[model samples]
Target: MTAPEKPRSPLARLFMGADHTLDRLLAYWFATCAFYMASLAVLVAEILAGTTPPQAGLILIGAGMAGVTSFYLLVRFSQRLGLEYWQLALYQAVWAMGCIIAAYAITGPIRGASMSLMLVVMVFCTFALRPRQAVALAATAVVCIGVTMWCMARLDPAQYPPAVELMNFILIALGMTGVTALSGAMNRLRARLKDQKAELQKALERIQTLATIDELTALANRRHAHAVLSAEEERIDGAPGPVCVALLDLDHFKLVNDRYGHACGDAVLRAFADAARPEVRNRDLFARWGGEEFLLMLPDTRLEDAHRVVARMKERVASVEVDGVPPALRITFSAGVVQRKAGEPLSDAITRADQAMYTAKSTGRDRVIAA
Candidate 1:
């Protein structure tokens, strides 16, 4: 036999990733805003400096425009190419690189390079993408930083702080990258655990539903009714009140099955169950007692009240229509109802109800006989 299928892993389930076009668009808008804000800050700072240069200001503004426009295009590409989270992360890394380079050009290397500390972007990505994708992002960030440093070292030696300071800069970047990677890993673990719990809960509920339900008529099955009656019996601690039990059976059910196909008979049984469900009180328990028969347990109810409920249910059953059947397709049920006698076993109450039901069936088809 083939093994049962297991659920897919959380990472595998995130196949769409940033392909959710709306999400990608929103992310791009936020990144664009960040770029604009960063550029504005640098522009104002350069204005404050006594040695403000016209070329530097234009470069800062140009970089901000490019970052925003590039992001807009990337968002459209993500939609067209159906990019996943990993691909989006790679794109974000490239965007970060451009921002860092722009900052370096406007300011010098040491002052501008600090902007690459946008490793904080990973925190947002951790919650946005899966762990594997986040890891991909950390790798990309490292590459971007290395490339930016190499280019700056060759083009502008005066911008480099000192050898020791450069070493410190690399160490700080690595440290921040480590923090982002660790946090992303923890978040993914939590997400996976939550998914597993939800799956388990649904599976357990299905099992319990199957155990209590009658397969034929979709009514509560016999085992459940017996368990409920036993529990109700235990609740009675020599109290003044008595429990009421009712047994119901379809009259001439065998004859109906003989006249119509078993499928039609099954339909009739289902109709009967549906009719009975509404008549039962919230506190009452109803179940199929096997083959055209049913049991009802009414806690703390008198025999008279039970009889009234049963009468209403029987009337409803008789009124039900069996589709595609003959006009004379009227059906009836017989019921036996009894209240618990002091010092009597729960089974005795059931037995009394059973006898009363048969008495109604023998006397006539459609009626309740209370004991």
Candidate 2:
């Protein structure tokens, strides 16, 4: 038999799953440092071939080591120091400039790879820095490369003629400027997309809330209550417990609406909902079934227990006083409680509960009945 494959460790998975901006920044830093070190090795080889002085080669190696060390330390400690994006970008720009200047000083700006290094620095800055900062860094790179080449040509005419050095510097400057503009445009587009995504998420949340909640009483609507009922019925099918449902209707609601205006009736309805909400457990679903009627679902509850809960809620509702209504005015609700049979459909249970509620209304206005 083939050996079973071992699962990957959590630490390995964590490293693989890390794709945040900080991870990208660290990857870029490491890649750039590696390229610089490779270039430094090449420069040393050129020195041994008598193309560069030994003293300049030594300086280049030392500068390359220092640059790598600085980048490593900054990346490792940046989180603890709470460095922000712009701060990291500024530090990186400064570090790149320092490395470029040091290399130019050692290898003569026009004859060595200093112009190419400056182009790499500009590209990385365009990616890492903000728009205005990237533009500023590009301009600084242009000026630095131009000044270095000019000074080198003026000091050594044989190695770097003025015309050729100026032309090369202009080409490098143009390239850096183009990269900066493109990166800025990309950054702006990315920012706009992020904002739009956040707005879309909030819109979706609002839509979900409106779909599930009743507008007047701020309770779950009939549709959501039915869904909860169905879920509870399914859960209790194989379990050794009961799921109970109660249908409640306000007593003499039509009379109240006729005596007082619809505004006062709405206030009474809202007050009843507020009073009854605290009586039910958190896991129970109390939703507005329709005008002046509500449904409550209790999971893992017995019929007698549900009857007692409804009795308490009925007493609470009778004591509730709507604002602007007279103290003499009273409110009461009649409830019908039913324990769902095992494997019974939720619609059948609701119908039975509705019948019981009507029976309670005919027998007496303010009482609880179980079916």
Candidate 3:
């Protein structure tokens, strides 16, 4: 899309970028902001109810909100640095974990509920991180939870019982493990689907080549030539310049096949195409019309220019040296060039070119004749 046309809406403007990558990063960043706000609300309730120390609670909440703002700015900066979404996302995930640990340390009996928050973090990671990354984060969470619970219980036995903390750790570990496994399975499935898509695209390209090209000469085939001719004919009325059609035939193809072998004849045919291909312009098409004949469609060309093109190709093909062909066997072609007129049918133009080619053959073995 053009630059001006991209994302002018107020909602899209808030993200500050029209790029799809930046949009996704901002999406996650916005989600992070919402999560932090909701978490602060819960912590505030605890502070009001006397379950958490108000002074410590306010400090933690302020720091958490500040961190959310900091991450948003960093995420925007990462867009300019060309960093990937996952890099910042992984870092934000770690920061969230830190906030959870801080909140757990300052709360009373409700400290056990931090395991649920940790579970939410693990599940959120599966959407962004790869399998290995998700597993690493899960492992880190396990260690942090264990250490925090051990310290809290030793400091206050009545508040955080050792048996209760142990059960919470086990449940947290099991939940994170399950989410990581699911992430791994999803990553594997995505890879398999990507491979299948590439293979299918290659197969379609091969099929298109076979449909439009001659395998032997690597030139457009008879069917493709017809299509191009029809299009040129249809555009003749308003075409910027004249369109020319030419038919060419090998001078002594059958004699070469009879004397040397079909192999040498095939070699000569391929050599002629290699010699003639360079003479063709971007607006022209060279096609194998039949067994020993070829057709050329030249757009924005006059009869004389088209004839000169074929004449140059004839000289090149005459000097070509094929691997199996004898030095005495010089390959050449006789062609008929004609400029198509307005309102003329494609078939009639081709018939005229074919007749001119036969006339060239009748007058001499190798020459270009324009009609």
Best by TM-score, which number?
A: 3
Clashing pairs in 3: none
lDDT of 2 by residue, 1-371 (tens): 98764555687345423334356656767787788777788787777777767987787688778877776667656777788766776777777776676666556533546657766666666556778888887788778778887887888877777887888877877888887888799789878998999999999999988888997898899888878877776677757478888999999888888988899899988999998998889899999999999999888889999999999898898888887778877788888899888777767887888989999999977888999
The residue ranges of model 3 lying beyond 4 angstroms of the native Cα positions read 1-14, 18-21, 35-57, 227-240
lDDT pick, better of 1 and 3:
3
Q: Give the TM-score of each candidate.
A: 0.57, 0.77, 0.85
Report how far off residue 170 is in candidate 1 (Å): 1.7
Runs of candidate 2 exceeding 4 Å displacement: 1-73, 101-128, 233-240, 323-326
- Which residue pairs in candidate 2 have backbone atoms (N, alpha carbon, C) closer than 3 angstroms, thus clashing? none
Write candidate 1's Cα lDDT for 1-371 as tens digits: 98764555666335324234355455656765685677567666765673335677666667667767676555555656677655665566566656654555446434544454565566656655777767666666666666666666666666654563367457746765786767677786878898999999999988898898898777778888788877777777556477899899988889878988788889889888887799887788888998999999888788888889899998888888886457587778889999988867789989999999889988976889998
For residues 173-233, what per-residue lDDT tens digits would candidate 3 score against the true structure?
Answer: 7887887788788878888898999999999999989999999999999998888877777
Better of 1 and 2 by TM-score: 2
Ordered by lDDT, highest first, the candidates read 3, 2, 1
lDDT at 59 for candidate 1?
66
Name the better of 1 and 3 by TM-score: 3
Clashes of each: 0, 0, 0
Better of 2 and 3 by TM-score: 3
